[model samples]
Target: MVSGTSRAAGNLSAEVTNLVGRRGESAEVRRLLAASRLVTLTGPGGVGKTRLAIDVARRLQSSFHDGAWLTALAQLTEPDLLVPTLMSAIDNGAYESVRVEELTALIGDRQMLLVLDNCEHLLDACAALTAEVLRSCPYIRVLTTSLEPLQIDGESLYRVPPLSVTLSGRTFGAAVAGSDAVKLFMQRARAFNPDFSTTEDEERAIVDLCRRLDGLPLAIELAAAATRAMPVKVLAERARDALTLRSAGSRTAPSRHQTLRATMDYTYQLCSGKAGKLWACMSVFRSGVDIVGLEQVCVGDDLPLEDLWSTLAELVDKSIVNLNGSRYVMLEVIRRYGQERLTELGEEDVVRSKLRSYVEDIVDELHSGWFGPGQQAVLARVLTERASVRDVLSDYLRKSADLRSGLRVAANLWPLWISSGNPAEGRHWLDALLTASTEPTQERAAALWVDARLTLMEGDLTGALRLLDECESVASALGDLVSLARATTCRGGAYLYAGRVEDAMPFLKRGVKLERNLQDDNPHRAVGMGELAFALILRGDLEGAEQVLNEAKAFCARHGEQLLLSWVLVYQGLVALLDERVGDCVALVVDALDRKRAVDDPLGITYAIEILGWASFARGDARRAAALLSANEVRAERPGTHLMRDMPMVEWHASYVGQVRERLGARAFEAAWERGRRLTGADLFDYALAAKVPAVHDAPDLPLTPREREIAELVAVGKTNKEIASTLVIAHRTVDTHVENILTKLDFKSRTQIAALFGARARPET
Candidate 1:
């Protein structure tokens, strides 16, 4: 019932590629034609489904004398509107006058191939409509590409696999003509690299390059572009580090598609100014972007909200971004390139300034407005722009003059982090801002205080101690009660981590006194009270802890700090756990988790999850505990004080359950324990502890040497290792060795971990 390609617009000849593989899919296509009117090619995005579909339709075009027609669905967004779009594409004017059944009947008997490209996004509509068309059409044929099968009736699915990477150099000549990947590569390379003439000797490396790219055509084309300035070998070498790097070699390929950069450049050029600007600024964000975040960051006072939708649409049309449901995202490579362009446009500084202001203003609002009637909507808006918020923090660490803005933002965002169980990322950014900023003020002290609290939230006593140690002098010098109070609370939290339970008491009590004296009665003060209660509970002072929780709750309610109130709820859970009221603990923790999310508190979320896991383990539900702990394990892999030292005790608690199961002779339990152990940081743990413990313990206060620190600082700002080596006048491998040493010294698992630590340690409150 699917429509055939004969209804396809545009020339079929230019679209079709001759059979270049050793075998043909003709038999498969003929079988698909016999079994189902619609055939969907489903696989990973960027696999050669489009080319394969075109070739299939071209071969079968003779059977459908009307001609093979291709109507691409790549740019379409709304699936519900597909029917009208399709009808218009085929220009079925008079057919509209007839019944829908009759209109489909008109084309049912026609023999043609209908090729639909990039139907993954609209898979549901594509499937339903294709099923209907197949039911209506008797002789028509359809071929489509998607990431997965549409699961439609009468649909025969053939997965298009990536090209084999095993082919040798001798196979290049034969392979260029015989392999679709080689042919695609040659087509792109011959146009770029004038010296791209593949000698017999060059054949092996070229094939190796293709293999390394997984033989995917798009990947090959991107790799081929790199050949312009690089030998095939060198191209492969650099590519090992950054797979997205386009070939250095130039070919006769169109400027728009010649290189990955060019393709992205073309996409950028097609966007409206605002869209381009937003897209480029979005590069500052590490993950996907949402509309709320976009509005806050991109649609400032200068850019009106009226222009936002149109700009987004333009970006969608140019394929500069993929609109996911309501949220939109740019690919990592594209985002990086866009960031470069944003800087070049001389608007980077302005954008950064605006972003910092937006964060400060919004966070201030969140602080005051959290418990208001519009709290729900406000929280949703905050959630929507959470990624962008993080991006702003990232920018501030690298460029902002006053660290106060970022520090305030970080302090305000604690609730969000707690709710999301992302203390690691939040704390990492907090640490980075504290280290990266060059300011000398209470703001820096506040940043250090926030950093300490974030680390405490993650249970990273060592990291907390490090930040607290730095803040001690600053708080004392400024006579900043909040900073001093928070620092004391943080120091207590760190002492708690090191199992110095009695030593932690005075600090927590001092923090409580300080919070009481603070004039604003903000959520941060509430947080300090909550931590005091938590410390009390940890020390088995249940009654005192309960008193502290009540105080925190009253403070939060009084200050409209609903988010901080939730952490007090989490503290209540901890109190229940201490009282052996495990079920009550579970309930309280779950409520805290929900409330944390409602207010966008990631640190609270992580704490809640950890408590939940701990309680679940106490309840003898190892399976559920393991499931919950798995998420925490993955989170721990990210750099942060909590992951490195403190909160890992929660993970260690879960690990104990798994270990217990293993000791009882359960293979599954052993496997799970091994996995959990693997998840915990070994060296980062050492580094975090080293930073906190005094030099008397010989813990290596600074994980990286001065040289490593210099390298790490550059890396935090997005410089490549090669760039770092060149800038530092060191050999590339020597730089590599230094990085490895840095990672080892700091107990970091990856560059991201180092970046997180560097971000934290780079700036100290002057």
Candidate 2:
């Protein structure tokens, strides 16, 4: 990872997609390197020079004895850090101090290839270093990427050309697809929309679009991603009105490449005056917005509402914004630049006020449908736009002087915060709101109980009690029964979490009665009923727990409430387990798991898995019990959930494990434990629910594949991806993929694990 001060040279970030074109350029670069010690690849920005160089290095790496290293200089600004950066990549994980004067000693006759990328800005420094390096290191070769030639002795320059986009005398056939530019455009368009395909007429439109973009890879990719919004012919028609292809090599290269802010300065210099203002105002939307959202926020004295269409068209012409379905999206780089421009224009507060109103309207619509048949739709919509809601709360609401409106918004959004398995996050927002708005109003009262409920769910018994005490008093003062009932239920749940079952009964009973009298249709009534059933189960009232759970479950079934229904079944499963109906208990938990998984509630899934583990232990299947419990621990790592922390099941783990160990013996029990830890994805759930076991290999096959082992051996000897690919006669991408799989199969995080295990087994020649 590149930090604030320096760049770490590792494998080039492996491209997730295939290399679209440039095969001929890759081969040509290799031939040039065989004749000259120093070669430079020059091209316009976004023309694919860096990718071509990486491909060439990967093919030629095996010939060199030392290694091939790509030192990206795109982010390096200060010329003084050049030597430190090269030394780090050359020495690779070593701290041996070597001065610039000792360049010959550092090289020492080793045959290595060095690829210095993005050298146009530091032309003088690059030339000075290249001259000194070629003179000192007799066996080393250097490759560089720049906007112009380095203009030095012993150097050959190769100017990379754009991808071919001509029809080649064919109207539309395989000959047309043979053009590198057409192939790249089709591949990138399908990557954005897998269903994208074209008729002959549409193919002509695509070829026209590529020709208009000058076959530049970056420009083509930006246009390709917009296929989801409109047809190719439609976009091509729009492109003619916006784009005017200016050939490269006419103007001098800009100084910045790596940082978007610096690149934005150059891009903004090219934009019209009206487009810049519209770009700045549009920055308030983190997620993409429709035309209506743009008009709602960006319409002001400086930017009229009607001007949005034309100014936005100019930006699209510049390939800054992409349209996806109903939304106009800016790439993250351009959006960050737009934010800086928004700050410069001094309209952040004015723009955010419009956003605040938009979110307020959205939340009000979301809350109104929470108890009816549209609840599922409401929850789905909440999940979809969760990012915008969070942005408004963070940017505008938190910094406001009066937090009453903020509190109202936050309190109403508790369903999303909980259904998304983010109760801890909900508590964070509510805690801030409660502290700021200390007045005892209806909004504060509701926010207090909401905070208390989330706090109790997170196992903070003391904190939940503190919030609920204030809530009870304020709700009583304001005569708000809804808030009072919610506080009472949370107080009971807090006591239950503390393992004081008898102390929880009276409060839970009163909460249920108050909720029922108020209205049985509210979601809070179901919440109270679920807690009251859990209290009944803990007190040995099995029959009573079943009756209460059935009622809540029926309510959930009618309203399509999967999240709360999952919880109701969890307690019902516990009641069945104590009733000695073991099969029923497992079936119930499995059903709950399906519902929890649907809502993406991982914590709820973990709890349900634990209940099945307990069911297995009670039936005397100690081996199955051990496996299920171990799998739960593995699943628990993501949600940061622990059976010992929130539930009264702490003693069960120790007691069940001892019995399991005695039955299976120490070694066999350890084998089972390791097997369970290795389970993940669908396999973990399958094993817990007694689904079919996934067939897997053992030994060398289980730990690493043959290709992975070969790569690991090369990696152990300090070879980077380019070196490994060259030595193994494979592509650099292939080597990176094998290394990633090796690490994942062995459960290792870094290549250091490869070095630790296979370092001694490296070949003598390497």
Candidate 3:
């Protein structure tokens, strides 16, 4: 019997969905496949290059005896290793360094299809390999995907166009329903709102969406994801803010996503020295930036602040920047690339220094508004400049100096973090500040208080207690009542997590008294109260918890603290669940979930989803619960220390064991569970709750014999049936007989899936 690793490539077709507007492209692809050895699909980023290539490759897979091989190049940073990676895929994990001539000699007479996916970044490597393979392998075919053509000899280039949007006679929703763009939209939209199917009334807005996105596939996919909750009209309106969405941007995709950056670079290069300086300086803001910040931060008397508007307009026209009503923003990817180029041109450090000056000026402005009518605007500005704030903090930390500015910024961001349910991230930044301190300083103690509060949410009682103790001594030494109150509240919460209810009560009461005595009206103090309430809830102090939560809610409302309000709601939901008020629990949990999503708190969002999953399971909707758990699993896997905070979710993964086993096959499911358990050990709860997914176990030793597996491998690697027969010294008919048996055994209706199964695996992301 063949082990899984040594078996022939599975024979199956690459799945493709040809939407309404894809009819013309489908025919065009068929025509191109007739005699093309290398049919390269070129288009701009988001212009449907990948989708188009997949669609065509799927249709043509059966013609070639050897199935198609797909190699994705997106995450590959090192180009020199590209050819070797391709060879490994085709040669069944073998890394033999055969010359190009020798490699081609093995497949000289093979009628095979090679599909190179996402080749834009490694275009040069792709071109050279394609040329070598095609020249040497007589019957081998290659299909490549890129943002632009290789422009190599004998290469047939097919430029993929965006979805057609000429549905004037049809209403927008109707138009989209009949188009490939709308199908893709519906697929992603269903993820957000499964009930959201295409409706006639929503057609005009859908068409507008596709049109504004220039019918580009990637842009459409991203925009479609937004439609889960947004109204079609709102989606269309928001599209205007993204300049690349405009149809006039470019018809041709320039070999990947860099086309937009290239445009921005060209525009920046042509700017007046002052305009160029202004552009680089504007990179400081994290969120959508505005003219006022630019003027206040970037403009001087020589490039007077009043004259900034014209430069902004010029930049917008040239697509160097985007305008969103009063707010202007640059695409995150484009902005990063532009920053790199600007640095290479010797303008980065100078621009960054000026950007710092701008950030400081803005923070000063924020300070005035913190007590004024524009507090809302002030908070928005702070959130927008969060990245810049971090930069400032890093600068202060590096100099080993205690700057009131950095401290003040950290304190101010506390309310923002609490509102956004991003206390975890907030605590991380706070800890960074504390770590930078050379001594056991009072300021570090203040930061510890913040960190301690965050630890409570993740049920980390020990860490919270230790940090709270550290905060107490420091705050006492500094004689700061506010800091003392924060430390006191954190200690109380830690006690509550540790089940020391009697000890928790006194500390919480003291914290409340301190806040009232000191006239501390800060929303952070309210967050402390909320934390205390959550602690009370945990200890079964229902009436007291209710009263405290109400007070905290009112306090948050008064301060317009959305993040805090959401947490209060989450606590209320948890209380309702504990009290067996399932309906109330669902309502409150759903509300908090919505709020978390609105604030973009992945950590909070995952937590809410986890609770929702449990709630769904309680409601006997295991399927729905499994789906929620699965989504949370994806979010929890985000790289770096972010994975550490998700330990609770890691424990909950066992709850989905049955569901995972049912969906991924018993063997595969069991393997993953064993791996996870080995990694996490007994601290994680143990349970197997999955239904086993069905597979054809009978094929273990049936149909295709060892000889068939060998022939299938060569056929998949671009060897013709005749070449394979000759290599194995078998009759050509015997090779054909083996191929038929192999296909039957694998249950693959087409060779593309066979090729794809051999190619698809868990590759490490660069």
Cα lDDT tens digits, model 1, 509-568, are 787677667666455567567766766776678999999788777766665656667778
Q: Per-residue alpha-carbon lDDT of model 3 for 100-176, expressed as tens digits?
A: 66567656776667778877557677788788888878787787876556668888877776677665335554545
Best by TM-score: 2
lDDT by candidate, in order shown: 0.64, 0.74, 0.61
Which stretches in model 2 have alpha-carbon errors above 4 Å? 1-252, 255-262, 269-275, 290-314, 323-327, 344-346, 370-377, 396-398, 637-642, 691-766
- Cα lDDT tens digits, model 2, 1-766, are 1113222333444556777778878888888999899999875556677878887776666667665788888768777777777887776654345567666578778777889997876778888988888888888889999766677998998877678886665546876778888888799788777888888888888888887666766556656766777788887876542222222221323344332244557567656778888778777777777787787778778777777888887766455666778788765446667887888878777778888887777788777777666766777766656667788778635576647888888899877766666787888788877777688999999999888877776677888899899999999999999999988888887787677878888899898888888865678878888888988988899999999999999997887677778889888998998899887887788789877776667667877878877786676555556677787777666533535555555555667778778877887678667866876766666556551111121123446767777787787678999998888899999888898897777655566546534532431101
Compare candidates 2 and 3 on lDDT and give the better one: 2
- By lDDT rank, best first, the candidates go 2, 1, 3
Candidate 2: the clashing residue pairs are none
**Candidate closer to the true structure by TM-score (higher is better), 1 or 3:** 1
Off by over 4 Å in 1: 1-53, 56-60, 66-219, 224-255, 260-312, 331-345, 365-394, 397-407, 410-439, 454-466, 469-472, 519-521, 534-541, 550-766
RMSD of each: 18.6, 21.7, 24.2
Taking the candidates one at a time, how many backbone clashes does each contain?
Answer: 63, 0, 21
Worst 10 residues of 3 by lDDT: 685-694
* TM-score of each prediction: 0.54, 0.58, 0.45
